[model samples]
Each structure stands twice: as C-alpha cells, then as structure tokens.
Target: MSKLMIDSFRGFRSFELRCPGHVVLSGVPRAGRSDVISALARVLLPESRTSPTMSDLWQTTITAAATGDTEPGKDEESSDGQPPAAAQRLSSVEPRPYANVEVTLTDLDPELEQLFEGFLERCGPDGCAVAEDQALPGAPWCVRLAYRLVYDSDVEALEQFVYYPLASNPTAGKYTRVPASTRRVLPVVMLSAGRPLQLRAGSPLRRVIDELDPAAAAAAFDVLRSRVTHAAEELAGHDAVAQAVGVALASGGVGACLTDTPLDTAQVGFRADDGSAEALLKSLQPTVNLDAAGPLALASHGSTAAAMLGVAEAIMLATAPGAVILADDFGDQVDTANAEHLAARLRASAGQLWLSTRRPEVARAFDPEELVRLTRHGGERTWHRLKRPADRGRIRAMRQLHTQLLPALTSPAVAITEGPHDLVVYGTVDRQRLPGAAPLSAAGVRLVAAGTGQDGGIGEIPVVADLARSLGFRVIALIDRDKAEEQTIKQIEASCDVVVRLPSRTAIEGAVLAGVDIAKVRAASATLTAFLSQDPADGVPDVKVVEVVKRSLHKKSLHEPFLDALVEETKTPPPMIVDVLNHVAAAASPSYSGPAVIDIPPIPLPSAASPS
Candidate 1:
C-alpha cells in the first residue's frame, strides 16, 4: 500500500490523495477527477511511459516574484516573507516549466523495502541543476522536496530523478529509467472512462493481464474464456437467452465461438453466420446472440454486464494483495444494485481501490469518510476528505433526501439553518426584497434545514456545516445566538466558512421583530396591542414580540402574510438578512473582495409615547 502526493502535476497545483484503502473520488465534471487517477498511475508505473488523454503538455512554469532584500548569506524575503529562497529565486528567474510526480511508500514489507532501496541507489541526483546558493540552511531532511519525473523538452525525453531527503545533501538525482523490478512490486490497474467493454484482443482486460503476468497470459485468457463459455452454455438452457440462440440457429445460422487472431488468446463469445463451413473458423469478429434475428457484440447485451465482466477479470488478475485498482466513473453503466455489489467485491478483493464517479447512487455505496471531493478554483485544485465517525444513521437519512439536497453539493455556497421554519423565514425574506435574486437557489446558494440535535436541542448547524465543508462547498451556518452554546457556536464558526448569528440574541424571528417598525406590526396584525400589553412600556422583551408574531402567523404558514408584512413594513432589510445576501453575492462572484458591513441602526420599539 502507498499514498500518492502530487504537486503541480497536470491540472493539480498541490493535493495529497491517500490510497491507504478503498477510496471513491467524486466531483462535478471537468473538476480534475480523471486527472488525479492518471497522475497516480503515472507515478506508480513511471517506466510504462503512459500519458493522460489530454496531451496539452502537463507542465507548470515557475517564476520568482520580486522580494525584499535580506542579509547576503541569508535567504531572500518575499513580500509575504514566507516562501523559501529557492522558491523565491525560481519565481524571480525566467519561468522554468516542468511536471512532478511523487509516491510515498507505506506499510512496505521487507521485500518491497529492498526493491525501493535498489531503485533509490540506481537513481541518484546526477543531472539535476543544484541550487546550492538558494538552498535553506539547516532544513530538516524529511521536509525537503523530492522529484520523480522532470520533462526536458529540449532533449524530448522524460528525465527520471530521485531525491533522497534523508541524505546530508538534498538534490534531485537523475537515472536512466525506473527499475522494472521496482515497478513489479507495485501493480496498478486503471479502468479509464473511455475503456471499451467489448472483449477484443486489445481490450482493457487483456492489457491488465499482460502487464501483470505475461507468462500466464495464455492461461489467464483460457480461464476467462471458459467462464464465458460456461455462462453462455448455462444461459442456452434458460428462458430468454435459450430462445434467442435457438431461433438464430434454426434460421440457417451457424454457432461459432468468438476467437482472437492468435489462437492462443481466445475468449468466450458467440458468432452467427450463414450455414457456410468456411465462415466458422475464418470469422474475423465474434458477436454474441442477444436477439432471435442475428448476433451482436457482447456489449450489445448492455454496458452493465460487459463492464461487470471486465472489472471481474481485472480484479481476478490483480492477484497481488497490495495491488491497486483505479476505476474512473466506476458504476456509471450499472444499476444501483449491481453498482453496490461491484463496490463490495472491489473492497473485499484489493488492498487499495480508487474509484471516481458523479452518480449519487455510486457515491452512497461506500462510507462517507472514504469519499474524497476534488474541487477546482481558478488554476488550482484541492482535495477534501470527509471527517470520520460520520453518523451512518444521519447518512441514511440524507440518502433519502439525496435528490432534494443534491444541488447543495454543487452549489457555490450553502447555508445550513436550525430547522425548516428558519429556512422558510430567511428564504422568504430574501426572496421578497430581492425579487429574481433568490439566494437559496437562483444565486447558487443552497439553504439546508438540519433538524434538531440528538439530545432534542435546536443546534444541528455544526454537524451540517461539517458535512458541507467535507463535500467542498463554501458553508455558512445560520444559528440562533440564544439556542446555541458559546462553545458550540465557536466550533461551527471555525468549521464553516461563515457563521451569521441573528442580531436579537435569539432566533431569526426575534431579529425580524426587533428590526421591523412597531407601526408596521400594528398595521399587519390588528391584535398586536394585546401581546405587547403584558410587557413594560420602556422596553419590550424579544420573547414577548416573538410570541406575538408566532401566534399571528400560526394560522397561515410563516412564509405567507406575516413575512409579506415584515418585508413591506420594514424600511430596510434586517441585519441577518443583509449579511446572508452579502455572503451569497460574494460566493456567486468569481473574485470575492471581502465581507461588506451594513450598518443599519436597530429600529426603536415603541416606548411610553407609543401609538396605543
């Protein structure tokens, strides 16, 4: 088992993808999901000379930005006074373009360590351009950067390099190539998105088998072909497949087993031809009989069956326990049941598995903590891992609401409220004031109503915020100041990108009542005087005002007449509402400047000189 860390590789800037066990990578399209898999494969099997689909040169240019002067012997200080002198000098010099891939071996057995040592000794920093002057003084051996591959286009070749940071001198050492012995220890099988399901001579299954054991290649095909033959023969006795194959044979058609050009590498498939003796042995292509009329490729049955068969072979052939299985868009072709079955089989078979998909059905098959989210911002990419000790019960509940809450996963910003009523209240106010500017939906901000906590308390904001952050969303929690403990509020603020508390030190309803004009309350509800009469005239407690509004809005839901009155009567939006809108706007924008401070003096409640 090994963990792969890639920095400035292809579409990634700096991200660590842990491959300790089974992992499922998911994100929106073109967010660099597939790139991660390809990069990992390249790192593990660098000698294979494999490149990704996008051949636009996976390289980044390094240029040193201007920095402040420092002591002659000391490192240069950048504007931030943080980046190392080598990095600062690199930024100041003419931009040098290169790509890097590094793999950190973990849980290595004695045999594997011996292989690593041999490879390390073979590849030393011979051709590397040493930056002795720019190197930092007394840097820890484990903290220095190491390189695996550097592309020098001038020579049009990939220059292999290995930097042993544990050594006294840390510099990239060059090598002719990575030892085949080293690569043999780590087996990586990648099921690309564009992989063909048809069992042809050059299919993905054949490629994997050939890579793993070229000697057993002949026997591996024999086993696979035998399985398909038995399956087809068994199906011949069944209802649907039997009927179809029988009809084709009865209509002057010959049953021919699909075989490759080379007799040694043959797979089980069906081919139908007119009852000609010459066609049986000379059939160039093999097709399976799916319908009564004729024959078609095995893929014609459906991608699900073909994909499952291919994956099964890949898993079987990846005999080594530490071997990795990488599948991009793992279950896109299969139904939920089959996808779940495949996920379980993959987990049980391999030491490590990496899967990428966009389907929620596929994502739900694995544990939430095993899911990694890849998010792209501008030119940089980041990977986010969900926290462990995830509430499986809550996850199941969330699965039920998957369709309704899916938009939140892809939204630019998500605001988690305490309950449904809070969502309705805040959502209604934002919609009323800013028509066609619905923050929850139109502005790409999702408002989630996380219900009460386990202890029946009203603060589920932190839990929901953590989930949102793990899924790579910019999260904001809207919590009541009074209901949440100070520590809980602080935790939510720290976990979430933003936390907006209601100004009245209570719920959103309190903020509305405190901000709305007293005249408007009287105008909206004719029975307002009765509720206020119980409190002192100098200053009415927020609880009394909340009670009045809750009772008045009870008959009609909170979104109806009451919210309408609050919107119409209030001269300006409440502070919480304003803050939410500001956050939404900032999230929607490509470049967020900063949080805007809207200072609207708290509306004065009617005092003794009140209108009675």
Candidate 2:
C-alpha cells in the first residue's frame, strides 16, 4: 500500500517540499506541525542529537530522583516475568542517535561558504567541535547546519556551537578546528503562537543571570524570585531602550526588579505547563490585548519580543547560505499587516520554507503558485497544489454558466420532459454545466403532467407555453416529432429553445437510458410494415432502390403495417392531428432541412404504449 506520512516525522520515508515553494500546512491543532518541524530540526542538527530528545534541559534534581534508587546489579523487579535490570541496562547503554535529515550547507546556500570558513577557522585546533570528525582521511570538513526554538532562548542558541565539529582528530586526542573550507550549512526554525501572548521572551532569568557572579550563575537561576512590576520605568533613563524593554515586560509572566526588588507578573511566564518543546510550539496561543487598543497596542508588553524573534529567523536565513526555515505560526491574530511583513521577509530569506496557514488571503500576500493547501481524505491528510489558469475567458464562461445559467434554470423554473429519462438526463446535464454545479434532482423540477390525451405525447409546444404560464418559470422542453406531431411543435416554439429534435423518434425513456441519439432512430412500425410484403419464410433482401428521374423504382418488401395504421388513424384523430400531418415528415426521407415533423397524413391518435 502506498501511503503518505502526514501526522508524524517518524513516519515519513523521504521528505521533499516542492521547489521555489512555500508550503501552507492548514490542519486542525494536534495535526502534527511540530512533528514535521522537529524532524527537520533533527536532520539539520544531528550532532547534538539525544535520546528522549531535549534531555539536556532536564534538571539534575529530576534526573536523580528518577534513577537514584535503582541498583546497578539488581534484577529484582520484573515486567512480564522479565527482570527490571534488563530494561534499565537497555536504557542505560548509550545508543548512538542520528539526525532526521542529513542536510548539507551546499543544498541551501552557496554564498555562505565564506561565513562557514571563517567560523571553522575560529574553532582552533583543540578539536572542541561537538561531534566526532570522521570522514575519508583528508576531505573538505563540513559542519551540520540545523537549529530550532519554540521561543528565543540562550540555550537554544548555543546548540549552534555544538552542531559542527569544533575541534578534530578524536582518535589522536588532537581536537582542533578543521579549516573553514569544509563546513555544512543548517536550517533555522522559530515557532510562533497560535492564540495569544504565550512566548516568554524577556524573562527575569536572563537579567538575573547577567547580574550574578561567574560562580553564582547556577545559584542565581535556582534562587531567582518571580515578581510582577509595572513596565513604565524600563524606559525612564533611556527613552528608546525603556520603551522596548517595558513593552517586552508587559507580555506577561516576567519577574522584574522593581526599585531593586524583583516582581513576578502572573500574566506571563515561561510555560509552566507540562509538555515537550514540540508540544509547546504546537499549542502556543497568540497574545490578546484587554485594552481596547488595536492588536499592536494590546501586544505592547511582548510585542517587541515576538517581533524581534521573527526578525531573527529572517536574519538567520538571510545571513546563512542554503538554509531552510519552517515557521509554524509566525504572525499574531489581530495584526495581519505584520504577518504580511513577515512573509515579505521570508521571500528575501536565504532558503525555501514550508508555511502552514488557515488564511486564504495569504496567497495574495505571496506568489500565487507558492501556496499549497493541506486537505484531508478519509483519515489521512494530503496536499493540493493550486495552479494558476492561463485563460481568463474560460474562467469567466464557467463562472457565468454556474452562477447565472444554472440558477435561472433551477430556481422558480418548470422542467418538462417528454418522458421520465428526459427529466433525469436534463437535470444531470444541467448540473455539469454550472459553476459549483450541483446535480438536478427530480424533486427540483415540476414535471407538468400531460393528461390522458390520445397519442399521450405533447409535442414541444404545449409543454413549453403551459409551463411558462402555470409555473411562472423559465421552461425547457424536449419534443418528439412522431409521424404527425408538427402542430404540437409549433405551439412549443414560443417558450422552448427547442435545441434539437430527434430525427429517428423513439420513446424518450429509451433515448435517455440507452444513451441513443434521436437524429437517427430506426422506425419500428415502418420497418415492420415494409417486411410484411415479403414471405415470412424468406429473409429480407439487402438492396437500395433509387427512382432516378422519377421513373418506376421500388424498395423491396414495402412496409405494410405503417401504411395500414396511418390509413386507419386518419379517419379518427384528435384536434392536434390537423396541425401534425401538414407540417411533419418521415425521418428516413433525405433533405431534412426543416425541424422534425409528423407528416404522416392524418394519423388518428392511438393508445399510448408504455416505454419498452
């Protein structure tokens, strides 16, 4: 079975985004935006990979408590009769982990070669690089370029340091920087909030750390107190700096030093909620302003912080060569214009990006072809690539057919079919002809019943006029020009388009179901009447007889039944018969320039037979 891995990064075989593209992943929450980004991060940052991912951030206290009491040799505890030691040892053994994507700098941006060369040279020969430097004996060394962050954090930023081989020659104990010539490029991603101000950008942690002594860096974090303080003073001494600082403080959950005292604002703080960075990025909410001020005013506190992060992602992409970026939700809700600005920044960024969105207008903000929609089928998600049309006239025509033609025909309109199938066929055809076209059902069209009139068929005329008058609707009708239905057709001309009349008349039911054309209907009665002249025991002859110059010419086996029926019916016919015979002609006759007619001389209306 061929399947697309849509919900998780672990499930994909090879991830490929369309080129010169921007992907718009629009799915409900929990649909896996973070999973995709996480996979991408893994591919870009393979060196610093870890089991139970992001394990470096876990506190020592929590780690000690979880593994503290377990004895190294104890196999006492068992699951399914298996000793716990086996599981413990299995977990304890440090299995090497690899990255999700093996992205190289060359794939993203070539211009960053100088930047990478310079970065590698600065590493010195200590070989302090984060990962093992093992390539063919002597080759162009490369650093993996990959980075990720739910919100801006110094720790997340430091990952870049360990992503590449800082120092080389692990086997010889000579760890030093491999020259700048061989380094890999990486991706940078920054996730934005979905609801309201949820990212803790300007927190007390950074400030307190800056104030602590070198040795107190660890204790300062542990003893840090959270307090709430109004932000008006951050700008007191320096107007520009304070305004920026004050706004960052207002985003919530910040403990500020008020008059040399720390104040923790309850509204905002680092996510105290339990979840991985992936989970946090996926669920983060946008900031809302309680103050009636527009979104910019409402987002006063954290607005600057969030804006700076977006700017950083742009700058990183622009500065780094061949780097891809995946921003989950880059713009806040109320400030759409800012989001547009962000999109412009992305266009100028170094690498391609895959942006998921719910806004249809987002396409207007970027190149039209760049937008790809995420759609669902049954239980799976799929991408729909939108292509711009080349012809505008065709689009206009389709629009008119759907919005105008279809509505007028279906609404407050009467439909008259010569038979049941005609009704169904017309409805089906009409549906396909409209824009956003919906199929027409029987219930939608009022079929005006033709009374028990002999020869039950109401030629086109009465069907059209009566429908227009009785139903007050635009009427469309199909008429059969049986051997004498001309008069009936003339009456319908006033109301019907009368597009085409079937030359080889048959039951409308048969025409509808068999998908047969009326222009070439073989006359059953005429053929049967002609065969009667031949002996029943003998086969009919296949020959064409033409009366050249009006001389004696005969078609073998004259159709007798048709002549007899016509002769008998001429004696007793309905009022419409007079009109039918004068205007109608046989379909088989050549030179059928006029509409289908019932030219059979004065045929009496016979009992209507049920469709065969």
Best by lDDT: 1
Model 2 C-alpha lDDT per residue in residues 1-612, reported as the tens digit of each score? 001112123323234443344554443333344455554444443432455343322111111113335476765675467445423432232212222232233232344545565443211132212232443333333343322212124443222122333433333434343222333233444444422233332222222233345466544333322111122222243556555555776556354534355542333323324533323333434454556755553245556455544444355435454445666554434255656666666756746665655433333455544554332223343343435435763333232222222223223334344543333334333433334332233223333323223323455335334423332343444454434365566666655532234334433322221221111112222334344553221232211111110011012322223223322333221223222221221221223345432222232223222346
Give the C-alpha miss distance for residue 354 in model 2, angstroms: 3.0
Pairs that collide, model 1:
63-91, 64-90, 64-91, 64-92, 124-173, 125-172, 125-173, 126-174
lDDT score for candidate 2 against the true structure: 0.37
N/CA/C clash count, model 2: 62
The C-alpha lDDT values of all candidates are 0.57, 0.37
lDDT of 2 at 235: 25
Q: Residues 278-372, candidate 1, lDDT per residue (tens digit)?
A: 23323333466755946776656777767777677667756775767878777878887788787778777777788887666666667766777
Q: Let me know the TM-score candidate 1 reaches against the reference structure.
A: 0.56
Off by over 4 Å in 2: 1-15, 27-31, 45-323, 349-351, 387-612
Candidate 2 Cα deviation (angstroms), residue 490: 30
